[model samples]
Target: MMGGELKRMDLTMCTTTHDPAPLSVEECERARLARDPAYDGRFFTCVQTTGIYCRPICPARPPKPENVTYCTTAAAAELSGYRPCLRCRPETAPFSPAWNGSQTTVARALRLIEDGALDGPGASVDGLADRLGVGARQLSRLFRKHAGATPLQVARTVRVQRAKRLLDDTDLSMTEIADQAGFGSLRRFNTVFAEVYHRPPSDYRNRKRKGRGSPTGHRALNPEPLRV
Candidate 1:
């Protein structure tokens, strides 16, 4: 676990940003053993033996010191193939403000992806990377490090989440919802929705009209970046 070393990227608009170094192993270990709520989201404990990651305040029995590694963010731990602890619910842990070099780049890329940069025909990660002034491979590494998921995964989650919101809040037809959510076609929308939520998109359509009409513009998209 190379904790906070960020390689330089070709992003010109933003100069190098320094993030605080991650908590030391000894500090994290002490916090975990004490189960200190004050230290909750500052760092996550990765137990190699169980392949699980937990908040410092996890009530579960601690793993041996040799088996544990510390990650600054849930994304980092998840990127390293550790699953979040059910007891600690690390996903719900308060976010840390610190971000290493490529993390800012990932954030920009995420916004672009969310705004349909990769939604339409001819859009690709290479194109998106070019917009961010980085290479496709480098962007992917940054995405994995900062988001714990691929860019496409993030886009797909955004689309699905937006589709769900459209389903619940609007009276849009399935086809319209599919298009608005960036799905190329209704069939494709149904397939992915079913795979993610284990239910078809139609099943989630809002039934109650209540004298409300669909908004002329699309609703705000705020998808929680899921680990797809």
Candidate 2:
């Protein structure tokens, strides 16, 4: 768990409607190398060599600092074309509630997105914005500025990351996994999984099973809110 003081600081940083005082590249690099838990959800380390992004607390050997870039959010890293690191699954990292500053509409929108509000049938950006009392265009701009991805992009990443966890931890069939992950069809699920992970779902599952002796522990896609 993060200390209350750091959580408060993160909230302050994220609440500003404009750009906040983001961690410097040098500071991020130091945190990544140090595996600092305090910085875990503050920024993600994307390795240029592997094209993978990981939580700062990732247990895999740290890559060379020169090959690393940092993103303010996992969504930002994914938008930059980096895949989540399998070893230190970014999906399992604690969600920073600070990202939802009380003043920003984007913060409320993000909470809805994380709760599968966008995964249901007939959900659309326009509808989501209407629910939040904003126009779709304004919502899109807010997402681009704060999350570094479109609403649809963030939703898709959330689904895919959830599916990845299911593949790793559950014995469910592919169809069931797809359904549970909120992918409307197995074809869509397969396409997105391959696009992000560079392999078919079954191949990833088989490889993971062979590598590990037991199922990896399951962590909910959304962690408990930051202790304020």
**Top model by TM-score, which number?**
2
What is the alpha-carbon lDDT of model 1 when measured against the actual structure?
Answer: 0.76
**126-224: candidate 2 lDDT, tens digit per residue:** 999999998899889888888788999988988988998999889999999998898889999999989888878998887666554445655435443
The regions of model 1 sitting more than 4 angstroms off are 1-100, 206-228
Residue 223, model 1: lDDT of 29
Q: Estimate the TM-score for candidate 2.
A: 0.49
Misplaced by over 4 Å in model 2 are: 1-103, 213-228
The deviation in Å at residue 87 for candidate 2 is 51
What local lDDT does model 2 show for residue 68? 70
Worst 10 residues of 2 by lDDT: 1-10
Report the Cα lDDT for candidate 2.
0.75
lDDT of each residue in 141-223, candidate 1, tens digit only: 99998899999999999999999889877878999999999999999899999899766776544222222334664443442
Summed over model 1, clashes come to 0
